[model samples]
Target chain A: MNHPWTGPRLARVALLLAVAVFGPAAGPRSGFETMSPELRAMQQDDLANPGMLHVAEGEAQFQQQGCTACHSAEAMQGVAARYPAFDAARDGPIDLAGRIAQCREERQGRAPLPREGKEMLALSVFVAHQSRGLPLTPNPDPRMEFVRRQGEALFRERRGQLNLSCGQCHDDNAGRRLAGSLIPEGHANGYPLYRLEWQGLGSLQRRLRNCMVGVRSEPFAPGAAEYIALEAFLAERARGLVVETPAVRP
Target chain B: MARTLLRVPGTAQRGEVVEIRTLIQHPMETGFRPGADGTVQPRDIIRRFTCLYNNRPVFEADLHPAIAANPYLTFTFVARESGVLAFIWEGDNGFSQTETRALTVA
Candidate 1:
């Protein structure tokens, strides 16, 4: 029998290790992969996962608000993938939360929901859940070009007392350790995820707020244009990645 | 409003053991933590969780602040016949939620 780790095999193993260490680092992997085994198991098991609770509540609200009277739940599928979509009526881009708020005000004749509130988070989770496994593809209309540009600027611009840009931590130094936590690639594929830090489900805006606070910068309001733009920017960066809404994160 | 998720096998063979899992949404806040005002928040957590199968007690747990938010619990029971499993969780400030799942045996 031939020895597997001698001569040519030894050289191949050395080359593989070198590439693994010096590779481009960025990948389409979900932040869920960085979680502990117990946390991963909780997310894999729907019955044991808390995020599903929010999904359930969101489903209930969708019906209670009479949304089902016109739009079938099935029709809502793939709808979230197109979010942060350009709204000609508003003459600007809007995310899933923004679009839902619009429907509440114009169609349902109801007041807009408070941003990041339980109802809003639940509704977002419920809608995003339907798009699970579908690749995200933000709208690319001409009107949205400026907004995406602003989003890109916001992501790369340095701000706050710490003077750190999002790209520095999430894009350049991802997979590295910081404050005992692994800095993920900061993808928005998993919004409204159940975070151990929050001990509950939260929206992408909520996570952005946390980052803002971390950098010691004043957080933008829930529906602020800045957050909306940043969300769009993140969505564009995560394009082609499968939606992982209601995910569990440590 | 509280949301609950329950997992139970759709069918099981007689005399076989089956797994049951459940999770519920709750803050499970520990009073030791300070609030936005920097004041110590009062402890609030789920106090008890109980499961009944066929109207008979199957499992029970006394939870504390140490339990994570959205308390989760799992257990197994032998399959004897078709029946309903009831889960009840009671906590601080009169918080309570109940859910039921069906089990069938062949």
Candidate 2:
């Protein structure tokens, strides 16, 4: 039988030891960099990435639904950057998905699609895709202080059978592996992304729900204000990072 | 609802090897897994995909249950003349979708 510590394994051990002793050679990288080359290529290719499909569909809906009569796609540029903003009408923080739902109801004079429905998700993806490369710049508002504080508490509070909070993995153990995948810093810069696990484009709330389920916690409903607050905190934390809308994650 | 997306070059030089890509929203269920109630879910998957240039076949694939949901494919073909590229997907439950794109060759 081959020796367990010989060759590449030994080299890997040596590399890990060096890293442990000397610390990492460089600053943190987006979880994007940790992906396979093929997945990276897919994220870079507009045509090959499946997430683009949803964005394209959203573009169609934007025009057909009469949004273009009021605003051009260019006008929506950088609009997503200010999402998870305070909405006085809702009396709470609202994410891009929530904002889109409100607009559909009030402006389009139509019943709003479910926040997580395909059409709404696609429309939000399409709108956010226009803001690609912009920074996560959620506008500051004094009214949102309470929500932001709540979000911080939730992020830090231990929950579920695992008794782990978002900070435990994303803040402390980031870059480490829990299962087969590396735990990212959990930035909200790239959202309405296509996750290979879901095999479809999903909102950040969907991802958050998945995280809750992973920890055996009861997930909040799709449109619950809790997710919006969490999103607000994440957006604030990820401020200045360029948006990677329609991001592909495995 | 099943939605399809195609990526074809809007403009290309004559005889260039243009890359065309396609993706479709599908579950591609394998019938192997149990549902929330512990009963086996039925199998449903897209089985065939075809791309036609100027009404002539250029690329095709026969997908299996093992394929992931939202099947994505990329293929290359010679840009001979300005024409239309038609993409077709056929699968279980009598599901089929066709989308077309225009190509300009100089």
Model 2: residues >4 Å from true position, as ranges? A1-29, A107-109, B9-18, B35-39, B53-56, B77-85, B100-106
What's the true lDDT of residue A66 in model 1?
Answer: 78
- Cα RMSD (Å) between model 1 and the true structure? 6.9
Chain B TM, per prediction:
0.94, 0.94
Model 1, residue A147: distance off in Å is 1.3
The residue ranges of model 1 lying beyond 4 angstroms of the native Cα positions read A1-22, A25-27
Angstrom error of the Cα, residue B90, model 2: value is: 1.8
Clashes of each: 1, 0
Name the top TM-score candidate: 1
Encode model 2's per-residue lDDT on B14-48: one tens digit a residue: 99999987878788998897889999999899989
Candidate topping DockQ: 1
lDDT (10s digit) by residue, model 1, range A157-206: 99799999999999889889998999988888878799988888888888
Give lDDT tens digits, candidate 2, residues A64-151.
Answer: 8888888899998898988878888867787888788788898778987877888888889999988887767777788777888898
Please give each candidate's TM-score. 0.89, 0.83
DockQ of each: 0.82, 0.55
